[model samples]
Target: MGITQVQRLSAGALKPLAALVDDLGLAAHFQGDAMLNGIDPVIRSPHRLGEASGTAQLLIGIAGAAVWHARTGKKTDIAIDIIDALHYLHPTHFVQQQGQPILVDAEHVEVNDIFLCRDNRHVMLEAGPPYMKLLKGYLNFFDCGNSKKSFAREVAKWDSEKLETAMATAGLPACRAFSREEWLAHPQGAALGQVPVIEIEKIADGKPVPFQTPALSPLQGVRVLDFTHVLAGPRSTRTLAEYGADVLHISSPAYPDTFAQHIGVDVGKRCAYLDLRNADDLVTMKRLAARADVFTNTYRPGVNARFGLLPAQLAAASERGIVCMTANAYGHSGPWAERPGFDQNGQVASGFAWKEGEPHKPRFSPVFYLGDLMTGYFAAAGMMAALLRRSTEGGSYHVTLSLTRSAMWVQELGFLETTRQASLPERDSYPARMTSIDSVYGKVSFLAPPLTFSNLALPNASRLSPYGADVPEWPA
Candidate 1:
C-alpha cells in the first residue's frame, strides 16, 4: 500500500532532524516489524507516522553534549553514559570543538547541555525548560511521551513552504541529492554490473570464496600499502586481503590501538608505524609506496595528498606500479569533504536514516562501515584488474571510494537490474551463505563428519579448553 499524504508530510517534518536520527543510530528500532514491536510510545508513535523528529533532536543534542564532555577528561560518567549512545552516529559532516562541550538545540528546544567535568570523574547536566528537558535524560528522547507528542504536533506544521522559507533565509547547507534516474545514469554503471558465471572455491584454510565472476580476482597480485587508521580503512584492506592480495598496514605513533582490539577481521596482518609529519617518516612512507603495488589511506581529503599520498601525487613513488585507493566519508567534491564524518553522515545522506524504524529508538550497528569495507574490497578488486591490464596493456590506475557512493551501493543488490539496465536472476543454485568454524584455544576445527565438503567458512568463537596446565593433544 502507498504511504498516506500525512505520512509523507510527517517525513518532511522529520527531515531537518535526520542528522540527529543518524547520530543515534535508531533505524532498525523504528520500522516495519519493529514499529509494531519496539518500545516507547513517544519515540515509537511518530515513527508510526513514518517520521522521527523529537527522537532525533533528542539524540543529536545528547550526542553533542556527550562528545563535548569527552574533551574535559574528568567526571566523565555522564558523558560516558551518553557517549556510547552517541557513537552510533558517524561520518558526520562536522568536527567537534576540541575543548568545549557540545550544545544541541532544535527550533529553540534545547535538548541537552551536558558537561564532562575536567577532572574526568563525574558528569553534570545543565537545566533546560521543562518542555525541552528530556534531551538531558536517556539518549532516547521518545522515552518522554508528552514531549514526543508535542514534538510531533510541532513537526506536522512544517511543510514545503516553511522549508523554502528556511532555505531562503537561513542559507541551507549545500548538499548533493541524486534522483533515481540520475544515479542510474552515472557512467560507472559498469562497476555495478554483475556477471553471471559463478565459482565457489575453498581458497583460505577457513574461508570460502563465493560467487566468483569474470569481473572478480581483478586485484590478484596487487600489494597494498595500508596507512588507514580505525575501522573503516583497515576493514577496507581486510577485504582486499580476502581477495588474495598482500596488505602491509602502517600505523602512526599517534594512532589509537582501540581498532585492533575491537575488530577481529584484522587478525591476519602485520603492522608498522611511521610519523608522517616528520621528514624522515615521510621519506620512509614514500619508499614503501615505491615498492607497493597499491596505496590506500583515509585521512580527511587533501591532508595526506599534499604530502605526496594522493593519487596524482603518488605517481612519482611507484616502482612496481601502484594503484592508490582513497576512501572518505564524503566524496572529494563536496563542501563537507574536509568536515569530519563516519557512518552517521553516510546513513543520513543515503536515505538509510529516514527509513530506519521507530524514530525514538537509537540506530544499531552504525559500526558496519559497509561502505568503507566494500570500498576497500572494490578498490582492491579494481587495482588487481588494473594491474593485470597494466601488465598486458600498461598504465597507472587510481580508484576512489566515497562514503556516499558506498552507502548508495548497499542498495545496488535490489536496484541494479532496474536502475542500471542490467540482467540479474531472481534466484541462484548456490546461494551466498555464511559457514561457521570453531577454535579451541589456538587450534581451529570445524563441526563436520570425517568426510566434509570443501569451502572456507568464517571462524566463530568456541569455548576454550580449561585443562589447567597440561592439556591433552588431539589425534591427527
Candidate 2:
C-alpha cells in the first residue's frame, strides 16, 4: 500500500508539518493551524529553504509546548515570524559582540575549501578539526602546504575520481559535486532516500515516570547531559536550554574547538571538558549519564560504543531510563554510515551543491548550513517526542538524525520555480528582531528565539559561558 498523507492544515504546502506531527505520533496533542504564520518566502532563495526551516522551528516550538501541556495539563498556542525563524538557521551570522559583528567565518580553514579537479569537476574538502589529522596526512602526501591556492593547484593534478578515491581510502572527508541525474543514481543517495528524516525507536523498557512540573519554563528541572560539538547537536541542546532544560555541554580538550565556533551556540548552557579515554573521566561520565534525563551526542555510530556509552548502555545505567538523541553527517544506515563528513559533504552528496549552479559549474549553498541547522531543529523535535513517550509509555527512546537526511527533506520541499522576480526584504527592520544581553565575551546582540508561545515571553538571550568553564556534575 502507498503511504497515506494526513491532512491537518488547509494549505497544501504545510503537509510536511502535518507529516512530521503524525510521524512523531503527536497528532493528538498538536493544536492550531498546521502551517506556521508569517514565514512565506522570508528565506527567499532558489528553493523553499525559508519555509522548510521555519516549519522545522515551528514543529520544535509546538513540541516544546506540547511537553509543557503534558506536564502541567495546560495547553498553549505556538507561532513564529518567517524572518525570525530564518535567522535561527544561521545563528552565528546574526551575533554581534561589543557593538561589532563577530567574524564567524574566520574559523573556516583555507585548505578546507572547494577546488576544481583535472576533470573539470569540483570537490569540497572538509578540513575541519574532526578530520584535521587525516586531512593533514593527505596534504602532506600531496606535498601541499596550508594554502587554499596551493591545495587547489596540487589537487588539480588528479581527476575527481582519483582524488575522491584517495581521500576515502585515507579516511578524510571529501565529496565531488554531481549533477542531479548523477546524484540520484549514486548508491548512498538512493539509500538516503529510503530512510526517514528522523528515526525513533524504543530501546529499553522501564517503569512509568511522570515529567517534573515546571515553575517557570516547560523544561525546568530536566537535566540534559550534552556530549555534542559543532553546530547541529549543540544547537539542538541550546534549543532545550532556551525552554529551561538544565543542559551541561561536554567537550574534549584532546579535540579542541575554537571560541568562534562555540561562542554563539554556547549560550544558556554550562560547558565542561572530559576525556572519556581516561578511567576517572569515564566513571564521571557514567555517573552523570545515570542521573541525566537525556543524553545527546553527535559522534559517529561506533565511536561511543567503544567507550560503552551507547544509547542502550546509557538507558541501562539510568534508574528512570533516559532519552538518547544522536546526530551525524551521513546517517546510521548504509555504506556511508560510518563515513566521516560535514554539512558541505552532505550538501554535495544530496545534490544541493549541483543544483545551486549551472551543469558545468557547481556552487555550494553559501547562504547557510541548512543541513546542520535543520537537523538541529529536527533532532530537538525528536528528543521532545521521545521525552513525551517516556512520560506516558515508560520506556527509553532513541532518536537519530543526520545531515544527509535533512538535506533530503530540503530537497523534498522542492524549489520555488516562480516567474515573478523578488528581492530579499530590507535589513533596516532587523534591529526590531534582535535583543541585547550581557555575555561572557562582552555586550552581545542576538536574534530572539524565532518560535513563540502565547503564555511565554521570548526566552532571554542565552547566558554565554567559556569552554570548560563549569564542573562536570549536574546542579543540586
Off by over 4 Å in 2: 1-13, 39-44, 106-108, 129-135, 418-432, 457-461
- lDDT per residue, candidate 1, 140-249, as tens digits? 42233334444343323434234223322432211222232433343322222221101011111211222123222323344677777544566556555544455567
Model 2 Cα shift for residue 127 (angstroms): 1.6
Best by lDDT: 2
Candidate 1: stretches off by over 4 Å = 1-221, 257-265, 358-369, 412-476
What lDDT tens digits, residue by residue, belong to model 2 across residues 427-458?
21233377777877888877766765766543
Estimate every model's Cα lDDT from 0 to 1: 0.37, 0.76
Where does candidate 2 have its weakest 10-residue lDDT segment? 1-10
In candidate 1, residue 467 scores what lDDT? 16
Poorest 10 consecutive residues by lDDT, candidate 1:
195-204
